[model samples]
Target: MALALAAPLAACGGGSDDSGADQESIGLLLPENKAGRYEAFDRRIISSRLSTLCLECKLEYRNAGARSDIQKRQFEALVNKGVKVIILDPVDAHAARSWVDAAAEKGVQVIAYDRLAEGDVAAYVSYDNEKIGRLQGKGILDALGSRAATADVVMLNGSPTDPNAPSFKKGAHEVLDGKVHKIVYEQDIPGWTEAEARKKMAEAIKDLGAAGFEAVYSANDGMAGGAAEALKSAGLKNVPLGGQDAELPALQRLVSGAQTFTIYKQVRPEAETAAEIAFRLLRGKSIKSLTPETADSKSKTGIPARLFNAQIVTKDNMEDTVIRDGVAPANWICTKELAAACKSLGLN
Candidate 1:
C-alpha cells in the first residue's frame, strides 16, 4: 500500500543524536483507557522502560479516551511540542492518516503502536491480532468440545474504525465460519467501549432471544464484561464466553466460570520493545534491526513491524499462564468470590 499524500515528508521527523542531548523528548499517545490495559500495562511499561533505558529522555503521554478528535489534537500537540518521536495508537485508523502526515511534516517520526495507523510510520509494535482471533475461535470450540457443530455463537467485535478489528474478525471467521452451528449475530462495537458493547449485547439478547446463542465471542475483556452483564440479566448460565487482553476482570471471570477463555498477549515485551525503538529512533539507529518483520497498512506496504505471539487463557490453565507469568496478581485474580475457583486452578 502507498502511504498518505504526506509520504514524501518522512525526512522531516528526526536527526542524529551527535550532541547527545541531556533530555530527549518522546511522545506516547495511547488509543484509550477503556480496556484498562493501555493504562495499567502499555503506558506504564513503556514509560518505565524508556526511563530505564534513557535516563535523560522525557516521555510525554496521553490517552484519547476513545475519541478520534482528541487523538488528533494530542498528536498535533505532541508534534508542536518538538518531540523527536511519537508512538501513536489511533482511535480511528483511517482518520489517523492526517495525524501521521502532520507529524511527518514536523519532522517527527511516528511509530504505529498496537493499532495500525493508515500512514507511513517508522515502526509498528503489537501482537499478531489475527492469531488473537484464531485463538478466540479455537477457545470457543474448545469450550464447546464435541458440541461445536451444534453450538450457536454471537460475535461482539471491536470498533470498525480500528484496523486491527478487521484483522481479528478475518482470522476468527477463518476458524469459525463453517465450524459452528450458527453465527446468530455479529456487530462491531462503535468505540470498543464497554458501554457500547453492553448496549449491543442487550440488543443481541432481544433479537436473538435469551437462549438463542450458546456462546459469545467478545473481541476483548471490556466487551466480555459487557457480554457477561447481558447474559446475567437474561438469566443465562454456563454460556461460553471468549475475550482477549487477559484483563483482571476477565481472568476473574475466567476462574469464576463467567468467561470461558481470554487471550494473553504478553504486553511487557511489546511495551518495552516500543520504548527501545523510540530511543533508537531518537538516537538515529536503524529500527529495522529490532523489528525485522513487516506489515502492510492501507497507505503503506513493507512497514517495519514487530508482532508478538498470544496465548489462550482458560480456567484450566489460569495459574500456569497469568499467575505463573506474573501477568496478573494472585490477589487480583483470586477474589473472595473466586477463591474456590482459583484454589482449584492452583492459582493460590
Candidate 2:
C-alpha cells in the first residue's frame, strides 16, 4: 500500500512563518483498492475536484490495502507532515478512534469518507448503507418471485471490522428475516476479501448440499464474483444472486445472468462532496450547508453527515441507472462474449 510520495509543495511565498500563508495540504486516505472504485473513481475525482477548488492546495494520498496498520501509519504521516484536513476511509473503523484522537490533539480535522470512523470526526460522507441493504434484500425477493416465501437464503456479509458492515447486515435482516423461509447460513467475511468469500461459499455449498439455499445475498459486487464462481463450480445454476456496488463486472454479470442485481451508489457526487468539505475546512469556512444530516458512531454523537441514496441495478434498468450516470459505458460492459446479451438488453 506504499505509494511513491508526490513532490513536496513549493515553499510559502515571502518566507512567511505560517505554513498556511500560501501552500496548503489535504490528505486522502482510502481503505483499499480491491473494490476498484477507490483507485478508478474516488481518488481521481477527489483529486481533480480539490485542484479545482484550491489552486495552491496540495493533495497527499494513500491506500491502506485493507491493512489497518498501514492506515494508522499513513494517518500519522499526514499529521506529522502538517496536513490540517484529512479525508479518511478507514480500513478498520473502530481502530480509528485512537488515530482520530491523536489527530485532534494536533489540531487536525478528520472527515470520515465512505466508512464512518469512530471518535470525534468533523464530518462523514457516504450512502445510506442500511437502506442499501434493504434495497439488496428487496432485490433478492424480486428475483425469487413466488419462491421467496419458501426460499432459504445464504447471506455473504462484509468485513467484521468495517463499521458499515453491521448496519448493512442489520438492514438486510430486517427485510429478509420474515420474508424468506429462513437464513440458512450466514458469515461475515473478514477484510471484505473475495477469496475468503469464495472459500466460505464453497463451504456453504458443501454443507448445505447445493440445494438448501435458493438465493445468495452478497454485501458487495467483489464478493458476489467470488460467490458466483463457487456456485458455478458446484453446478448450482439459476439461483438468484445479488450484491451492491454497480461495478463494471457486476453489470456484465447481470447481462450474462450470472448475477441478478446490484446497488448503484453514484460515487462522483460523494467524492466531490468530500473534496468541497475539505476545501471549506482548509479555508476555515463553514460546512454547515454541505452537511445537513447527523449520524452517530460508537464514539461520537450528532456528527455532521451527508448520506446519498442508492438504486438497485438490474439487467432491465441498465440503460436508466449506471449507463445514464456514465458510471460504465455500453462499450465497456459489452464484450465479444456478451455482445448478444448486451443487444438483447438494449445496451448496444
Candidate 3:
C-alpha cells in the first residue's frame, strides 16, 4: 500500500545528481488507488526499471486518491523532499497545471505519467488515446459478427472530469459514428466506477429492453464487466460488449463468454519508456527522439508528447496478446471454470 519501496535506482547502475553527487532521488506521483494496475504492476515495473537505470536513485511514491487538492499536496511533499525529478499522473489534468509550473520554478523536471497535464511537461508518456478508442469501437463491430450493421449499441462513457475519458470516447466515436443503425442509449458515467456503470446500464436495459440492444460500448474493462453484469441480470444473452485495459477479470469473462473484447496496452514498455525518459531529462540530456508530436491541452499549446499504439485483444487472441506479453499470468486468466472456455476460444 505504501508503494512497495525499494533501493535507490542509482544503486543498480551508476548515476549522480546534476552537481555530480552520488544520490539522485526521483519522486513518482500516481493518480488514484481505484484501479489495481497503478499500484501493483505499473508502479513495480517503473520503480524496478528506474532503480536499474539510476543505481542509488531513490523513488518516492505517493497516491493522489483521485482528488486534485490531495495530488497538489503530494506534489509539494515530494518537492519539499528535494527530489531532482517527479513523475506524476495528474488526478485532474487542467487543475494540476499550477503544480507543473511550481515544479518547474523549483528546477524539478516533471514527467506527466499516463495522463497529460495542462502545462508544458518535461516529457509525456502514454498510449495513443484516439487509437485506443478506435480499437474499442472496432472491437464492438467485430464482436457483433453478422449483426454489426444492425446492432443497437449503448455507450457507457467515463467521467467528464478526466481528459483521457473524453479522448477515448472521441476515438470510439470515430469508428462507430454513422456506421451502426441506432444508438439506443448514450450516457457518461460520472465516477467511472463499475457500480455506477451497472446502475446506468440497468436503466438502459429498462429503456431499450433486451431485444433492442445488440451491444454495449463500455469504455474500459471495468465498466465493460459492469455492462455485462447488467445484461446478465436482465436475463439477456449474446450481447456483444466492448472494453479496454485487458483486466484479469474481464479477460476471464471473455474466455467464459460473458464479455466480448478488451484492448491490451503494453504497460511494461510504456512504464520503462517513461522511466528512461525521466532519467535522461534529469541528466540534462536531449530527448527529442522520444517525442513523436505536439499535443494541445486546454491551457497549453503544442505540448511535446510520446505516444504509443494500442492492440486489440478479443477472446480468441488473449493468449497471444496479454498473456504472451506477461501483462497477466496464464493461471490467473485461464482458470478451472474457464478451462473448457479457454480451449474453446483457443486461449491455451
Candidate 4:
C-alpha cells in the first residue's frame, strides 16, 4: 500500500498550536454523530486511556457530520485555537490532505484515527479494512449457502471519499469475485448517512426491477438499516444482509432475523491504542516499534500503524464476542422484551 502524508497546519482552517511554549492540548476530531459508537465508545475509551496515562493533557473534541467541507473548516478551527497534537478520523480522506498539510506546517502532530486519512501523519490507527470487507463478503456468502452462486447481492458500500470504501470493496470482491451470481446494485453511500443509504437503496430496488435482488452486502450497520428498510418496502422476506459495527439496533435486527451478521472490530483496543500513540507523540517520544504493521498512504511511505482484527458477529455468537470482550453486556440486550431470546441464546 502507498501512503500519502499531508500534515499542513496552515490549510487546516486555523487549528494549530501557536503558543510560544511547549504546553499542548490534544484535539480529537471524529467524522460524524450519526454513528452511535463514536459517542458511546470511541471518545470515552480514547479519553479514558489518555487520562490513565497522564492528567496534564487536555482533549478537544468535535464532529464533522460526514462532510469534508465541514471537516476542513473544523480542522482549521482546532489548529487556530492552539492544539498540540491532533487525532483525526477523516471525513473525506483526499480532501483531508490539505488540512493535514496545514497541521504539519504548524509543527503540530496529527494522528490518523480509525478511518485512514490521506497523506503523512504522526501515526495511524485502525483495523484491517480489507479484512472487514472480506469478512462481510464471506458472511453473506455463508448465509446464502446453496444460493451463493445463484443469488443477486446488492452492494451498499461506504462513502466514496473515505479511503476505507475502496479497500472494503476490494476485500469483498476478493471473496465474491467470480463465484457470486450477480451484483444487481453496487453503490457507495456518502458520509455513511442513514438518509442517504435509505434513498440510494430505494433507488436500487427500483433499478433492480422489483424482487430481482436476493441478498445485500452493506458496509456498515447504519447503511444496513437503510437497506433493510428498502427491502421491507420491496416486501421481500428472509434474504441475508451483511453489516459491520455490532451496534444495538443491528444486533436487535439480527435477533429478529432482519439482518444476518456484522463485523465486530474490538473498538476498545483501537481507541486505547490510539490514545497511547497520541500521548506518546505528545511527550516527544518515539512510537515506531510499538506498531505491529506498516500502512502505505499516498503522500507518505511505510507509516507505522496499528491494525486490529475484526470478528464476525451474529445473533448466536454475540455472547462469545462482545460479551466476552466487555464491549457490551447482557443487561442492555437482554431487556424485558428480549428476555426469552437472551435466555435462548444462552446469555444470562
Q: Listing every candidate in turn, what is its Cα RMSD in Å to the true structure after a full C-alpha superposition?
A: 7.4, 4.8, 4.2, 6.4
TM-scores of all candidate predictions against the true structure: 0.91, 0.93, 0.91, 0.90
Per-residue lDDT over 140-242 for candidate 1, one digit per residue giving the tens place of the 0 to 100 score? 9999988889888899998889999988998898899899999999999988778888888899999988878888999989999998988888888899999
**What tens-digit string does per-residue lDDT give for candidate 4 at 171-235?**
99999877688888888887787778888888988887666777889999999998888778888
Number of colliding residue pairs in model 1: 5
In model 4, where is the ten-residue run with the lowest total lDDT? 1-10
Model 1 pairs whose backbones collide: 2-299, 3-299, 12-107, 13-107, 13-108
| Greater-lDDT candidate between 3 and 4 | 4
Model 2 scores a TM of: 0.93
Which candidate number maximizes TM-score?
2
The window of 10 residues in a row where model 3 has the poorest summed lDDT is: 13-22
Off by over 4 Å in 1: 1-23
lDDT agreement of model 3 with the native: 0.79
Model 2, 148-247: lDDT tens digits are 9999999999999999998899989989989999998999999887899999999999999978899999999999999999999999888899999998
Off by over 4 Å in 3: 1-23
Instruction: Give the per-residue Cα lDDT of candidate 3 at 267.
Output: 80
Candidates in order have lDDT scores of 0.82, 0.87, 0.79, 0.81
The CA lDDT at 220 in model 3 is 88
Clashes of each: 5, 0, 12, 43
Clashing pairs in 2: none
